[model samples]
Target chain A: MTIKILGTGCPKCKQTVDIVNKAVAKLGADIKVEKVEDIIKIMEYNVISTPVVVVDESVKIKGRVPTMSEITALIQAS
Target chain B: MFDWLIYFSDWLIYDVSGLSEGSRLGTALSFFVYDVIKILILLFLISFIMGIVNVYFPVEKLRNYLNSRKLYGLEYLFSAIFGAITPFCSCSSVPLFIGFVQGGIPLGVTFSFLITSPLVNEIALALFLGMFGWKVTLIYAITGILLGTFGGFILGKLDLKDWLTDWVKDIMAKTYEKGDTVTADSINFIKELPLISREAWHIVKGVLLYIIIGIGIGAAMHGYVPENFFEQYLGGGQWWTVPAAVIIAVPMYANAAAIVPVIQVLVVKGVPLGTAIAFMMSTVGLSLPEATLLKKVMTFKLISVFFLVVTVFIVASGYLFNLVL
Candidate 1:
């Protein structure tokens, strides 16, 4: 499974990556987490805001930064 | 509440420190403790409320609508309001600026969003409320919005398409217009509570240091920095102070978060409210980095014009505030 974090590497976007990565580690899953910074690529997912999280090709969250608990839960279900 | 705080300060200074309450050390300590507790609490509440409010604005949907439509009179107003919620800085704002232009939104509306988003920010509001109270904060916000709206309206009216870089102008010609109806997901506030709290917490943490430093500086200046540090500009109602403040701030640029404390210190150290506000608006509105980023899309002529217009507006706002407040 793959997780995509969308943002142009703002401070909050960086925090989102760290949270998602830590969640993946705790689950002991070999899932790959990627940073999708390109605006066109992000818009392709129909996302309007930065720091969006995409799990397995489905749009999950956007705009606001998610906490560790929220990230772990979103990823675990995926 | 203030009485309680006053009593607490007196007790701490007289009973704990054995220092006379009239001493400078006593006053500084009291001011420091009272301000820190009060401001931090205010910051927490305001952030929480703003977080709750932010959930209602479907920004992507709003942007999608702005991109697709050709709003004439209302465009500037909507764009200015939307700018308040956009989560972007100068660098990150570039991609979105490109997207807006490519989507066929007018250059002026885009400029409105770009200008007000950073100028009248939540962080700035929170800090200002913590330090200067709501009345001054309200005036600052109103001026910021007006600047965005009015500046954008005039710029858009000029229709300076030729001033934009060739690539941006080319993108403006592209016809990838989406439909008008924006089917945003129905929002549920209860479900968003967790995110709201987390967002508020992050905001509180982000500016915790600024508040500490701001209050620290205010505390130090409370009894230290000579009361008449700015005396030369006071007695005669220094009419030139506002413009002078803007000139000083233009070269030494900083964001609201970093400079707000400095602004607080300036006000505490005898600078007029109008002068302080003018300096702040200059910092936010005409920063060198923002100008550089805008230069990507704007010509030298338009860029220089934008700065010139915004500076005049800021200086005017300062003088107006001095006259009224």
Candidate 2:
């Protein structure tokens, strides 16, 4: 599964990247995590806020950093 | 409402710490303790409530709503009000600004959101309510909303579309003219409580240091500064003080949480209430970093014009406040 994180490189966005990585590692999931920082690409997602976590091109989180457990639950569900 | 906090502060300072009542150090510490506790409690509660509201009324939904209809100039007011409730870090403002413009929201309406987002928010509201009471808080809130509304209206009327950088103009040309439908996920309130609480606590954690520093400065001024210390310079009669305060504040940047408590002390130390409010508004609303970020989409001319318009409104509000309050 591919998880794309979209943001404009703000601190929260960077932190979201770290948390998502840790969540993936903790869950022992072989997920491909990608960070999308380009504004034009981010706009394609139709979200005004960031950092957004997209699982298979579907938005799961936007505008806030998700906690570890929440990320795990999301990964598990997906 | 917080008499118990006052009593506890008094006991802690006088009985526990053995500081004599009414002494400078004693008074300062006591004031600090009382204000810190009161403001913290208020911040947590208000943020929690606002978090719930945000969960229900998501920003994407609001953006779509704004984009779908023309509010007959009430859009400016709605934008300003929307900006007040939706919180995001100022660093992320560029993307959001671009998104609004790309979504076909008017540049002027987006300006309203940008102007008031930082100047007035739940943290500022809670701090103001805790320190200045409801009357001042209500006046401040109303004035902030009006400042954004009128400032944005004037900017919108100017038709500064050509002033945008070519990059933004390019995007504007290509993108569709309205916001797309945003699907909001449905979750029961009980199931969302943890997320809401986390968000609220996250906000509180983010601003806790600013609150402390702000209230610490306030306490120091409260205890040690002689009466009329700032009155000599920023007194109500001085016509230049209002504009001067706004100008001085424009370049410096601090969140409203840090500035509000200090503003409370400034008013107490004989700075005119209007002048202090102007300073707070300018400091939070306009900043060098934000200007730098806007350089992405706006030319230097547009940025300067944006700053000048907002500054004038803030200065005018300062004078109006001085006259009325």
Candidate 3:
């Protein structure tokens, strides 16, 4: 499974990265967490806000950082 | 409404601390205490209420609404109002700006949103109401809206589409694609309280330092500066001071929360209300970091034009306020 974090390098995006990594580590998941920072690439996702979490190609969250529990739940569900 | 707070501050400083009522230290500390408590309460209340409102009426819906409507130029007003309500961080502006442009919103309308989003917001509103009286707050809010409306209208007429950077132009030329929309979950106010509270607390924590430092400087000025110190230099009669204040403020970026308290003290020190407000607006509205971010989307010429137009309006409003108020 793959998780893509879309942002333009904002502080919140960095926080989102940290939280997602920790959540993945805790859950012992084999998910590949990738960061999408290019503006054009981010726009391709059609998101106006940053720090979006895309599980596979579907956007799970956008515009805010999700909690660890939320991330773990999302990973397990996906 | 805050008489109890005033009374409590007086008692704490004069009775409990045993400081003389009129002493400089006593006056400054009291001012600090009253202002800090009052502003914090107001901030939390406003943030909580606004958070609830934002959740119910998502900004994405508003953006789509603005894009789909042709409001006979009243869209500028609506866009400015939208800007005032949405609470995106400054760094996220570029993406939002591109989104608006891609969504077929007029350049001017988008400009209106960009101009007012940072300048007039709930936090600024609460700060203004807490520090200054409602009358000043009302006037300031109206002026900010008007500034965005007029500033955007003028920019829209400039036909500066080519002023956008090549990368933006390339993106604009591409066929627009609509992203998947997140459907709002059913209303559950009971479950939403925690989220609302977290948002409110987040806002308060974000500006806590600014509030302290701003009020700290204000308290010092209140205690030590002579009543006429600022007035003597930046008096209402000085035509140059208004423009000078705006110019000086353009490069120095500070949020409204930090600047408002200092502005209140400046007014108390006898600086013209108009001049002080102009400085506050310019400082909050125009900044080097925001400009650098915009470079990703707009050419240097367009950015300069945007700044010049806004600066002129701020200076004009400053003069108008001096004449009327």
Candidate 4:
């Protein structure tokens, strides 16, 4: 599964990626995480608020940083 | 071809031409000009964008939504969103805050807007992405919004009705921009172009001064300051440094966009990212002007809460960055 962060590379978006990686590593799960910083492509996701988290092409979280445990739960539910 | 000319000249004087110690004076002069030009451009660009954001964005609508409390975290979320787009310096946001309060907006929600406005913005976002890459930028944005939301909510719960200044209360009772739609106000594109140009010009006119001020200070720090002093003293080792830095920074404001480059320089000189970030938050997010302006509307007690909320957020963010980033 792929986890993509959508935003024009602000600090919050960067933290989300870091937290996600840690969560994924903690779970011993192999998932690809990408930081998408291009504004035009981020707009395509129909996201106005930034630091959006997209898992498998569907946005899972928008405008908020999810906790590591919350992210682990999200990945498991997916 | 044009780019190569400037590059070649710079190389020739600094590297190739290799004038002995006698020509060091000339090289230093040229270097000063270069730094001055860069700072000027940055200030001009940021100020221009500020004007556009002020003129264009439908902020009153957003203010209304935040005031209405239509969603649980929605106001906080939107406050973050709008905050990013409109890059107002800490002092500049005070007038807007007064406007928001007078529009019947809740103080807590307005506080959220105030908190996020300085910490996260388009220019800073772009600068962070360009300098530190995507990961660092994302973390700053998310944490900034969270702080704003939490701070706003806490202030809302406090309900300090008596804390407001009498003049501000009077201003709140008076209506100024009634029934005026943000977009409905027609600007004469032809005449306004010059006016916009003039505003842009005036904004840029002081660029040389700001650049001189920013770089004179930055270069001295670059040249004179010990490389590991910040890291060893405040960032990595000292537990109290985070809160201290936040407290120290609130009274001294500098635009985040301008400060990022300085932070980048600091980090290069071995300053810890956490400490640098705390300083950045303080300098941009809280300043003497903002506190003085807030005094116009809020009593000392309310101002105390406001400072407490922001200072805590800055400290938390610094520690969070230390742990995560």
lDDT of 2: 0.84
| List of clashing residue pairs for candidate 2 | none
- Report how far off residue B165 is in candidate 3 (Å): 1.4
- Ordered by lDDT, highest first, the candidates read 3, 2, 1, 4
Which residue segments of model 3 deviate by more than 4 Å? B10-23
User: Fnat of each prediction?
Assistant: 0.19, 0.41, 0.41, 0.00
lDDT of 3 by residue, B140-182 (tens): 8888888999999999999889999998888888877664667
B168-192, model 4: which lDDT tens digit per residue?
6776677644423424467555644
A1-78 in candidate 3: lDDT tens per residue? 999999888778988999999999998889999999888888787778777999999988877777788899999997
Better of 1 and 4 by lDDT: 1
Q: For residues B8-118, could you state the per-residue lDDT of candidate 1 as single tens digits?
A: 867877789898867878877877777666666666776677666667755556677776677767888889888875544555566567767666677888878877877
lDDT against the true structure, each candidate: 0.74, 0.84, 0.85, 0.66
Query: How well does candidate 3 score on lDDT at residue B30?
Result: 89
lDDT of 2 at A58: 88
Tens digits of per-residue lDDT for model 4 on A3-55? 89875554556667898999889988879989886543664554444567889
